[model samples]
Target chain A: MAKITGQVQMLFDLNKCLGCQTCTSACKTAWTDKDQGQEYMYWNNVETVPGRGYPKGWQTMGGGFKACTNQVDLSAPLPSINRDYGAPWEYNYDEVLTTEGGDATVGMLVPAPRPDAPNDYSSNWDEDVGAGAHPDAYYFYLPRICNHCSKPACVAACPRKAVYKREEDGIVLIDQDRCRGYRYCIKGCPYKKIYWNPIVKKSQKCIFCYPRLENEDPENPLAKNFCVTQCVGRIRWVAYAEDTTSNLYKLVNVWRVGLRLHPEFGTEPNTFYIPPLSPRVTNGTAPRIPTDLLAEMFGDNCSQTFEQRKARVEEVFAILEQERAKVAAGGTSELVDILTSYSESDRIQL
Target chain B: MPLWPKDTLTTGRSPRVLFVWGANYLNQAKGFLDVYQTLWPKLDLIVDLNFRMDTTALYADVVLPATSWFEMWNLNTTDLHSYIIPFTPVIPPQFGSRSDWQIWQGLADALANTGVVFQDSLPDGTTITRDYATLGTDFRTLNTDGQDLSDDKDACQFLLDSSVETNGLTMDGIAEQPARLLETSEEWTSDLLPNQAYYGFQRMTEHLKPLHTLTGRQQFYIDHDWYLSDFREELPVYKPPVDADLYPLRWITPHGRWSIHSTYRDLKFQLRMQRGRPIVYLSPSEAQARGLLDNDPVEVLNDHGSLVAHLCVSPRLPAGMALMYHGWESYMLKNNLDDTSGFKNGWQGPCTIRIKPTQLVGGYAQLKFRLNYWGPTGNQKDTRVQVVKYAGTLP
Candidate 1:
């Protein structure tokens, strides 16, 4: 393993996500849509937890370091082209136009048949299907992008060493010019972040919008990461982990409320999640999504991690509530000042 | 007053000819496409003037392309914002397409050449006949005679120069900034002003001036004849929704978060995030009762019509309520079954549910005859429906 320097990190608060997909659309329009090879690729995606994600069943295919044996498993079955990533569907508008009209009571308008096979699955195949029964079912959106890990498996498995972690920000990127179409990086990633571009005959993954980062001035607190600034829910925070004054550091290290996804993979992922808080069901009981299932997805410490995160979130909510009361009584509080000051100068520090 | 053109068409008294502009009837109206299909042969002509080759344009006897927004000069006023915005063209209209204003002008000129006469009866019982030649000459004169306001730019300039609302503002000024603040009687110190009254009502409190009302003051009760009619809806009162008890689920279709109405609904990048199809949201419990699951094909049916969409078990949605975001076109929908069909294979276009008409009684003060003021409105939210698992293939 190589010693990493200052690492850029991100935290997503699940409690705030509205599943609007503004972040996904923004990323696509900015980066991927121009290339024909990038049609099936989404560097960022929001999938419903406890549901089949994009590429159908991505969670079961395994890779990354095996902690029990203390060695990386380079061999893993690659994601399927047909079953995993569904072909994009195109519509038949001309058929709807040319069809003849029927009688008033029986007239109908039908379009030409859709292109069948190989494209059956879509990006959000299982949307909103949660784990619980009836009125008590609970689900939350889990937005995924490349983790840009401290110990990226893609870097280790590439035969040509095309994948490398930047020393400056610890962002993992594939060297497109140096790479051949071996797909070893795709199998090596436990998160399934690496995607194969058939047209380019190369492997590609998220670059954390590194070009935007290069343009950012350290002195400007308002200079934000692409996904963080584009989020309509305001759920994401991004900053270098070494920047002590950032909200990212305060939330991740000082408060210890942010939990890394699947820590057992031994990849040291930079992205973190603030577990969601579900409201009590209409049956007047605490809503529950089986703890064991969460543990399976998040690793063995899921219960303890969730408890610590929930307590800190409750504290923040209490402060917000108290400040709201003061505002109602025609008085201002410092809590309001801290929350409202999101301008460029106040949000970040070099 | 409650009569819809569809009802008239169904009764075999359809219009002789139809001319459509600035509206996508197939996309916005319920059961409109079906009606068009049935009545296409019966009608003499169907003309459409639109920018895109939308569903309605395909069926038109003559499809005249209109200028896109970026190629036209326009003004927009919105209640949500304080400024009046102007849209200046970036380029000329492409591929022989004309601006809506120019197209209408040409049509008027051509009709005048036909030497037609139009007769109308006035409110005081006076009948008047207008010669097309004179009417056309008068219309053209407004754009000519040293004014030279034949083009859209000249027309827009005249509007800015004449209106007191836009005092001290010009077309050039608006073109430079894209928006201008509507001037008020107050002194000019700031570029913006409060939307409503900025100060307290001193005239009403200190001078005791009468309000603009029927009694010259605020009145809680209305003494209008219609208000005291058999319905007796004189004062505001609680009334349950019309279809509250007819069906198990209340249907709600709110504006989509991705687009404004149907404006950007078809953007490929935007559609990728929305599962490439329309979705109906339901609670897990409600879904279980109907044998539905996430991404399962389901048909939402009511007396008005039936639409097929993939079901989504949304935890945020409440029980006994179904939600579908508005603005998906009929063509985008799958297995849009007709209401008259008895659960058999039917057309596969987008199916819009039935719309109910609200109260149409008018003629009272504040409710007198006016365009878009007092008329029958579509009661979209007042709908009930049942969901059944669909055993259909995707289109």
Candidate 2:
């Protein structure tokens, strides 16, 4: 079942996790910061899986679910995102004005590093917080981000030809210079990994460390992608997602595909999950569930389960359903025309 | 001092920091150490202030309630150029919530209340400075040429020809302000510094130095190597703690993106990510092998305290590790945490433990109450909610 791109996925066993957020913090520190991060972000979210996911309505809200189909419409204008998704382009014109007698000087130079307070306090201040609540309680974190599907919805929804999926490894990327910030891709993507940057005013998401991925050192370039490498609990992993000779991906799809994350949403997200074994299910001997689900779940890029990708104009198409602008006044059904269904390979174009 | 936090507080010899860092800010923590090392303090005994309630607090002498980021004066303009914005009260100090400055202010007022006045001004007086208004209220009304603009805009203004002091300002010609942090290296070259007050302090500590202390200007550092006897022959010498077993888990509890410590716990929007049950996270495989569940409730136990949460199984974490976002409360539960709940206190102070026994809105259990009393307990199993969204980065 290996995909054409030879891409594989991974699954994490929550029971083994100690909730030591080394992976989450390491990622934020290593990659999610810097000017590129801020507005359009969350390359990693260590969400409590027992609740609603990190992104509010990503699964059922976007385009609803659909079975895979091959024909995708390339020329249709892509969908739009939530109105306030970007922001008010406030002008930081502080420099444009000057104080009369008091010159418009920088006035002060703050320290790059603040002085070490004798006592630096924070919220989680206990020596052993979150301990001893249940006789046999289990609380584990699930790190989430862009799955970079073998067939990326973002690549299909771009009107500006701004997004592309890398051929070598199916990592989806946005060319900032080419992106007009139409926000169409953001809405179309079920994963919602793409983000609109207010500073640069462009879309951004995880790059899968392409530069590091192509390096000759043999070790994953993002060997230190913050999370995988620096986890104090040793619960993380880093490997070539393409090669299935590894046990990571094979275990995911083959051993445990029944436990899926919002599968009804049709993005074909690459990140897979070995559903948490609840106390009820595991009251019996939990199957010696293979430790490696990474390759099995997503290792196959050409999964036939994903071939039928572009049958559009379904009712779940939020923006196209006039969900973007409250359609009070009468206007041509821009939706019916743009997303008008056709049997051509591009099928329902929108 | 052990770079890695010691299981027990390090004392009698050198400084040891039990840095309770947030996974959301690993770089910020590392960046902090790189700078904090420059100004090592005299004595050390530590208990970090991460959000989770399980870290050891037995060693802490005074459990002072502290201010959150938004609660304080967070004045920032440009990169390094900015003025201090006075801290404004947000929600009437979440029951017993107190600012770090107020803690000192309260201590100062208490000390004064006892008639034992200390030579130093209140410790947190510098939370923000009225450095400008210090000259006098007339500074705001004064005209360009030093005329009282209250009377007439075209009035003939006059510079004070003689030395005159009213309140803190003087009639001695206008003082020139420093252009930036470090305009001249010579100013930082010597120990003797300016006598005038800048911000709130009169002395020239690193805070008052020119901004470019990055070039070895006004930075502070201390060498604790002399106090170490357990050093190995490692080149970049570091002494791993001998008592790592006392607290095996390198404790970390991060704040919610917008939750100010214990605040915003039971609020509907905030609880969306977590399905109403306190959860600790682990890999699914571990949960399976150990009879754990995708969303099974469990107790997080350590020497200091314990918390109850739902299980989150995913590959996002490493083995033998777990994490719980801080600011959970018993009040978040539809049913209050009871003795039968088998839960223990994970954290206290910071208005977190400020609670009253009130009936839960939905259920028949009674729990401790507070402004926003959050704890680690509940029956949230098999739940997932979406919490964030974006404009147009994805297709």
Which candidate should be chosen as best, given lDDT against the real structure?
1
lDDT of 2 by residue, B30-145 (tens): 11221223323432543334322211221222234454654543222222221112223444445465554445444444444454322333344433332322233233234455
Q: What is the C-alpha DockQ of each candidate?
A: 0.22, 0.02
Worst 10 residues of 1 chain A by lDDT: A103-112
| Local distance difference test scores for all models | 0.67, 0.39
At residue A230, what lDDT does model 1 achieve? 77
lDDT of 1 at B205: 51
lDDT of each residue in B1-395, candidate 1, tens digit only: 43444356468676768788887665566444456456566778888888876556655677788998889887666433446577778998999999887887788788789898888766556789977875555655564454655588767767766655576677778878765456532332122345443343334555566554577566656667666675566786677776442778988878877676665665555665556666789987799998776678888776545677777776667798888887665555553324334442211122334433224555555454455646655555557778889886554
Worst 10 residues of 2 chain A by lDDT: A118-127
A1-350 per-residue lDDT for model 1 (tens digits):
46778798877777678888877777777888888788778788888888778667777677777763336666667877556877665444444434455321222232112212444466765666566666577788888899998777788888898999988889899999999989888877878888898898999888888887777765654555566677877777777888987877776666555667776676778988766656676667553554445445553232335555345445544544577699889998654443354553333332
> How close is each model in CA RMSD to the real structure?
6.2, 24.0
Candidate 2 stretches with Cα past 4 Å from truth are A1-8, A18-20, A36-40, A70-140, A216-224, A233-242, A253-260, A281-350, B1-395
